[model samples]
Target chain A: MSKLRPTNRSILRRLALFAGLTCFVAIVMFPFYWQLVTSISPPGQLTQLTLIPDLNNASTDAYFFIFRERNFGRYLYNSFGVASLSTLFGISIASFSAYAIARMSFPGKALLLGLVLSIAMFPQIAIISPIFLFMRDMGLRNTWLGLIIPYMTFSLPLSMWYLTAFFKTIPDSLEDAARIDGCTPIQAFSKVIFPLALPGVFTAAILTFIYAWNEYLFALTINTQDAARTMPVGITMFQGEYTLPWVETSAAVVSVTVPLAIVVLIFQQRIISGATAGAVKE
Target chain B: MEIRKTDGSRLRKGLSERQTAYALILPAMLVIFAVAVFPLLQTFYISLFDLRLNHPTRNARHFVHKLNLEQYVDMTDRGRSALASLSDSDVSDDVLRRLPAIGETLDRLHDTLVSNPDRLDQYERVRDLVVTFEPVRESSLRYFRISGLEANEALSLAEQLQDDVARAIAATRESPSRQLRVLEQISQDVGRSIVYPNFIGLGHYAAHFADTRLWSSLINTMTFVGFAVLFELVFGMLIALLINRKFLGRGAIRATVLIPWSIPAAVSALIWRYMYDGQFGIVARALDAVGLIGDSSVMLSTGSGAMVSLIVADIWKTTPFMALLLLGGLQTIDGTLYESARVDGARSYQQFFRITLPLLKNTMMVAIIFRSLDTFKVFDLVYVLTAGGPANATETLSVFAYRLMFRQMNFGSGSAVAVVVFICITLLSVVYVKALDSDMLTGHK
Candidate 1:
């Protein structure tokens, strides 16, 4: 009762908590603020000591420069191509595996699950050079196929994990009822179960696409040609071509990341849950 | 009972179900194998051999001592023509005498290579293929094995003869001609024909045992992961606890937390890089104002400073994910447990230590394991930020391997370093599984 009272001690504790939370929030949000500030600041004002840009003078010149000069539009197009294709491939393959894991009584199910989890954690560096070599030999290097296959491969484990958990929640009785009504197992899955699993599939697709979009090392190594490079690799390489042009670099960074930020904001709950799907379930 | 007379239709249905399950999983399994398993195995295999693309002689893995026929044939033909012209050269007698000795050395080389009729035939076949502008079909046939001793002997003899001829030609300064100089160049080409075997099994890995660079990079990697993850775990848990409460705008706060994570790592690196810029970075100026660091430039300029800057950047980027994970763990803890503790007159801190911390262990372990592995393989952040620069001080294992393999084009050494990274990752995985064996076994469901 004494501690619960609004005594000086309790007031100090409340102030401490608020201070901690404010610092945490500020630190978490400052980078985006800085990114935005740098993006809008006039090229001449980039080296200004102030953290915030002068609103009246802030210009979109850097953005126009990114599009007109750096060819970031092409990078965006390539990134979208790789990300969406990989997501489609990842979701499709993961659907069946998730279906089997969720519905079937397969031998080695545990082993398969363990293997998928391990693959999710496989370091990309370990296989990067080999993938480069193999792709070159197969004449796939610098092609979209080169980046998509590895992206799909790495995306499978996470997609499968998310989808399997989702599929488990759907009742088997619906599929069985469809079977009894004269639908084939595949038909039963497609008509009855597949519709029910949309949310999970969407989550997996979004996550996979984000993974493919944001993946750097594979995209960097696999696509040496400028025409084939993805956004992350493209933008990183932009830094090399332009010598520390913070305004233009920030413009490019904001353009690539703003869409993601907006999407995450709009779908905050879904994205958060999906991202923490593994840990939450455990 | 009547064996249930397994209904024919039902039996067929069951068989079809099993088949469908197999059919469903087949594509995913194939993709995983082709893209993940095969390359990993290939990496391991390649690391066992010396496969440097830069070296003319040992550019590829050689299972046995091999002489390059394309090289040998070209050299021998050039040598013979040079000798033919040199015998009639208007150079001094000393130079003319030297031509025969070079011819003798060339002859000896030809005899050693041609001693094995099978090889000589292959060599002749390769020469005809080359002359006809036909490509060699097999890498193996393109270079045939010679006795290591014989190859060494031929190499030295050709080299010596080349030097001798060049000296004699140079001595005939009065009769110096472009033809004599071309002869000197041809002999040098002949000297470079021997290709050594490149099978260095476990040699690359063996070399790392004493490799200081490898050790330093490994240490850097471990230090980065250890400090970053530890701080992330603590601060992440605190943030999770702070935000896990039912507060207004908590959803907005949660989304705000995810922003750093949603942004591409390369983008995050760029932002941090500018923010930490010595002259203009707001963060650098702020830190300097607060006296946390001596100056902003020192942030990315010094070894320890670069490492610190990187760790701070990593912590900033990843701690939110940690918080999200821990929040997931926090949610699973029953609200009633805290109410019951309150009724029993336990303080909040007491309840936290006894209840929340214990319940959050599994999720924490999983989070830490995942984050540690991620931090260990950190390449891009270090790459785009400090570039492991200011004297190789911040070079993590992955960046080190990238430089070796892609930059230096030393695939053999790079692959070897990659394998070392694989071993480190495996060790981390084993530790995680061992620590959370029962948790992992039960968590999948």
Candidate 2:
């Protein structure tokens, strides 16, 4: 094929592909670059029309302002606490259900799976107000549990799906052999299959944690008080508070996103696989 | 493939595995029911009645005609005492003759509260709280909700007494004393005893159907979904094909591609918002230089510009995930099919059309429909970026519902908007389910 085509034309084609890929990569990355630049830029330089970033003059004052004056430290603490608890709860509950769905053939197994799929996709807006009402009635408003329960439950569908697919990939013979060794079903599962399914559980927990960490609507509605507000809601509140510098918003966003970005980068393979787990059966 | 899942479990079912399975799944199902399903049902129920949190009397769902005894008792009592203390010089002879009737009317109303065996004790407790100046925050104690005939009579009587005070105050303007003025002021302060029935059956739904805002948002939502999914599918397919090819730095490239999808949506919105800033946004300036946009500010400052900006941001953020979905489909295509086609002397483009495109159709369809559904319920991005701003020209249904429920405190209308969204999504889901009636759904082999 190289011999058939002219050398000049082939070079042009190669150059075009390289440029397209470079442009795509640039498009994917420029926002974060802009975010970093904006976060580091001081209030005086925020409105400057310079396209290039100024790193030497960068300041951490915006970060300090958010932590000190805006109570973003509380929001960060709240987000971490809620996301961790939600992941823990989601992982624990999903393990058993995933095991059952993957292992046994219950009567309503098909029906249950269908229901789970839809519930996983249930729109949060539909339930936001009712949950608010229930939270108020249960005295859960501005409480950690108010946000935790919804986050954990909403994540159940995906967690269960991935865990089920993960559990399915594990052979049943291990547990069968454990049963033959005089172990009960629970004991066999704990000793044999659970160990094999640990990776799936971890992956499910990562996804769930990300889901909880990124969540804003429930956090905003349920946790109205500064004591319980999460990072996403707290940062949005930064605006309309005496017309502060736009740099503060950038600082808050970078602080929240960088950790998640780092984690996702490290676990990119597992996260990617977990997302496409059962969706592509082939 | 695993017939043992049926026969094997049945043969070794000594430990009640069915019961165990149910028990294991019970907690997850219960949580889902409580958090999602129950609240969703409750939202539907709330949408039937007017639940405006900002409105004092209509904050909660009212089941019957109710009296606000706290305000009623205090104001009526003040009116009667103020009228009785009036001097002879303060009013005309006719008004003096009418004073006893109005006083008796007030006492009778008070006597009803004090005399009723069911309400007398509760009324006294409420009176004590009012006198001590404590806020009756609890609705159960403050609002006297009843379905009895007394509810109607008390409501009418309160109105009549208020009217009488007005008449007396107007009639004695010539002798204007502070006593009658106090009575008039108290009567004016006394609110209606009849609590409003906020139950508007299908009223919100009907009103929304007629609302232009809802239609505009629906248009915005569909436009965003349509354009986002379309561009995502096409570009995602191209990216998937490119990355799926053998490359040296493929792992690094894949990780780079996953950045947008990995970052939380709200953070993505903020990043885009900064870059699309009218005056200082780099991307805006770039677009202006390329003549893609007339100006940098128009993207967030105009309706068409905002919509286009939203679609572009969505495409940028989600095309990576879309590519991943398609890549999953791409990997499933047997490699030998391409080798065999090459042996048949088929060109690369021909092989792609014959071997790859046909096989990738299912994943493409499913990814598009699923992506469409996700885009339909977008709130965080639109909310954080523009907040349906630039005069709310960018408001989608979810944004509209958020404003109605949380911002406007109209849960009823908001829930109505929610239910409308639910119905639309459920319809789309049914289509998704129909498309997914394959072996993957059954999970057998």
Q: DockQ for model 2?
A: 0.57
Native A-B contacts reproduced, model 1: 0.72
Error of 1 at B157 (Å): 3.1
- What proportion of the true contacts does each candidate reproduce? 0.72, 0.61
Candidate 1 Cα errors over 4 Å, as ranges: A1-21, A240-242, B1-14, B87-94, B174-176, B438-445
- Superposed by TM-score, candidate 2 places the C-alpha of residue A276 at a distance from the truth, in angstroms, of 1.6
lDDT, candidate 2, A25-120, per-residue tens: 888987777777888886687667355866678788988888888888998899899999989988899898889899876788898888898986
| lDDT by residue (tens digit), candidate 1, A41-114 | 87676667366568898788889998999879999999999999999988999998999989886677888898
**Ignoring the other chain, what TM-score does chain B have in each prediction?**
0.92, 0.85
Best by lDDT: 1
TM per candidate comes to: 0.93, 0.90
| lDDT by residue for model 1 (B163-192), tens | 877776767858667666766787777756
Q: Give Cα distance to truth, residue B35, candidate 1, Å.
A: 1.7
